[model samples]
Target: MTSFRQSDRLRNVRYDVRGPILTEAMRLEAEGHDVLRLNLGNMHPFGLEARPEIVDAVAAGLAPAQAYSDSRGIPEAREAVAEHYRRCGIDDVSADDVFLGNGVSELITLTLQALVNPGDEILVPAPDYPTWTGAVNLTGGVPVHYLADEANGWNPSIEDIESKVTPRTRALVMINPNNPTGAVYSEETVRGIADIARRHDLILLSDEIYEELVFGDARHHHAARTAGDDVLCLTFGGLSKAYRVCGYRAGWVVATGPLHRAADLLEGVTLLSNMRVCPNVSGQYAIPVALGAGAPGSPLPADIVDPDGSLERRLALTADALNAIPGVTCVPPRGALYCFPRIDREMFGVADDEAFVLDLLHTEHILVTHGTGFNWPEPDHFRIVCLPDEHVLTRAVASIGDYLARRRR
Candidate 1:
């Protein structure tokens, strides 16, 4: 019998957000624990439904999808994606440059695998989406953490980025309307990052999956639009968040600007796409309808929207409630469906973020991911999904407050 050993690449990866804690939470819930799950940002589980038009289109195309389509993607879906980017002010992108896959998760991995050489470095945000770090590591590339300044509303610091770059740095990742913190970068910030990319000749990987979920008065600048032809950019987006179709597993990556230099990288993606054959074909069929002109009626329920049909009211409700809790102070989220709050370690006698989360789960029956889960260097924070009903969120926060008060005693 042969002894099997785990790969070294897998050894360094730690996805604490969805790892042991989530697993234990699920197990406890299966046994009838009343767990208010605020860990994952997935919208489907919180009652966000897919657009009716999208559903109808996917149903219509199901039979045809039984056969293999183009490796890049179904022609119509790729065309729709290309047009979507054009509308978003990214010029010179075409269907030929689009590669569809099973969610942005698959596309991110494919892009990293294609571009990274062993010991190459990619600039990723500290307190970033863990998958960015994991993907870079899996490809034998090092992920250098660049600080997103919390003092400046969680914006990426240009000086911090410049200080981190080395000859080995080959790419920079931009998660606008970032995960966990939910801070949307301004146009100035985007341009600054783009300038750095141009100066260093690094590929810009913009993960804009939450582009349509901007809340309050915040505006999201498409990074590729500002970066122009000097820098090669790959913008990744999909139907997961905005369209509320996570199960569809539909995502596309668009290559823009100086794509000629990336011929080998593009070919690698093509080969990888061919190996998978195609993304979920049913999901591909729905892209046109989802990205097309608005559906006749509002896809969301009235309660889900404010009178202005914006998510601002809900955002405020969650932010205010979280801030009201002792030992918890969340910077108001501008976009995306999360509020990452810094927990006061001294106030609650909480030694670390994971310990705080574990205590909350055991006592309050609520689940949240620790800061370390998102590659945050310190244990002073935790992320909360803001999709729960206003009343439910209020109760959850109050429960956390009660736990804090008890701990202080």
Candidate 2:
């Protein structure tokens, strides 16, 4: 028998969010251990259910979904996506500019496969969601990590980004209400990144998946809107995080900025979209309903999680609990469903974060992703999903605190 090897394209590919630690967690659960998985933004597993409207919409469309639709998506869902972007302040967008896929995950992959040839350079933020890194590598592109200013509310350092830019750089990827960090980009930050893309003639790929999940006064300024009609920009959004509809796998990407410049990339996207036939039909049904219900003027709250307590309340409670632990300092995330907390490395005698995460799983039955998992160039940080309720977060953080205290002793 021959030993099989992975494709050469996979040499740099990684999806650490569900990497080795999660595999071990599953093994433990199979052996009857109760594992509290704080690894990813999977709200359903943590008491939050999908919105009732989304459920109904998908069920209603199941019959019609039996047949193939357009490669892009159904007309109504695409129209809804166009309008959603128009409302977000992006101009000149129409249904024709929208492309739907199984998820932002798939759409991003399609875009990368189209945009990057071997050795093409793309700038990705450090501590990225990992999807960007994985896709870039799979597409044979080189992903250059630009460090975000951790002390400056996790904002991407414009100087760092510009310094890293080279003639070979093809694009810049930005994740607002960032995964892991949950730091909402300020308007200045958004415009600054847009300015970089515009000046450098680089395509901007903005992942705004958590656009509606902003907490308190922190706002999510759509990056494409800030880039205007000058730079070639692509904005992505979906019903996963905010709607708690991860399983639906419904996501859309809109090409914005100068239409002429994006013609080639758009053509590439069309080819890939055609290859896939179309995105999931039942999932497309939820797009119109989800976007329509999220209209700006609506007075009703849209959160499907924590009906008893508001999203703001839950977010605040979770951040407070995590910060209360000794040697654990977390920036109160202004948005998104996670909080990446920094631990005192010396105090815990921790060097390898992945090993530390495994130890925590065995000792406390709690599972979390190491910072390195998200490409955070360090071993002292870890991300926790705040989807779990306040009580659960409190308990989880306490367990971490206890574990650290014992290590210090």
Candidate 3:
């Protein structure tokens, strides 16, 4: 018998968000242990649900969805996505520019596969949503990590990004309301990145999955708007996070800023889309209602979209609780469903963050991912999902505080 192995393309890929830690969590679950999973931004399990209108839309479309639609997506959903962007101030878009996918995850893979050649280099944030790095690797592209300035509210360092560009660099990827860090990019930062892409002739890939999840004054600047008419930009968004429909697998990528310049690339993407047949048909039904109900002039019902502002409240409470602990500090998340806290490694005698996470899981039955899993260069950080209610979140943070207390040197 031959020993089978994964393709060499997977050699450099890593998606530790659901890697060994999740495996350990499942193992513990099999043993009848209750494991609190704080690793992924999965919301439904925590009671965040899709709007009834969106649900009804999908349910009603089930019969029609039995047949495959166009390769790009169902017409109504694509137009809805394009209109959603037009309302957000990206004016020149239309349904023809939209390509719907199973989810942003699949779109990421498709986009990378279409754009990357063997040695192409893609600039990705140091602590990005790991899928970006993993997808780039899977497409045989080199993911160059550009450090986001932690002291400066976790914004991408413009200087660092500019310095990393080379002849081989093909694109720049930015994740606003960044996962694992929860830092929303400022308007100036977004424009600055756009400027870099414009000058370097590199494609701009903006992941704005958490666009509507911003807290307080932290606004999400659309890269397509900032990239304007010269630089080509691809904006990725979905119903997974803000819509609380993770399992629906509905997402889209909109091509903006000089489509003519990206004709070849878009052609490749379309080719791949054709190969996949089409995105989930019933899931695509949710997009039109989801966007229409949440339009600028019209707002989604409170109960459907974070009624009572509990999401913000939970995030604030979790950050405060984590900061209250000795030798631990959390940069308050301005947006998104996570808090990436930095621990004093020397004070805790900790070197490997993955080991620390595993220990915490075994000792406390809590599961959180290591920072390195998101491609953070250091091991002093870890991400926790803030989807749990205030009471559950407080208890979870306290349990983490207690675990840290015992590990302190």
Best by lDDT: 3
Cα RMSD for candidates in order: 2.6, 1.9, 1.6
Global lDDT of each candidate? 0.85, 0.87, 0.92
lDDT by residue for model 3 over 166-272, one digit each (tens)?
A: 99999999999789789999999999999999999999999999888888888889999988899899999999988888899999999998888889999999999
Off by over 4 Å in 1: 1-3, 293-310
Using lDDT as the yardstick, the better of models 1 and 3 is: 3
Measured against the true structure, the TM-scores of the candidates, in listed sequence, are 0.95, 0.96, 0.98
Top candidate when judged by TM-score against the true structure: 3
Q: List the residue pairs that clash in candidate 1.
A: none
TM-score of candidate 1 relative to the true fold:
0.95
Query: Sort by TM-score, best first: what order?
Result: 3, 2, 1
Candidate 3 is scored at a TM of: 0.98
Error of 1 at 37 (Å): 1.2
Model 3, poorest ten-residue lDDT window?
294-303
Q: What would you estimate as the lDDT of candidate 1? A: 0.85
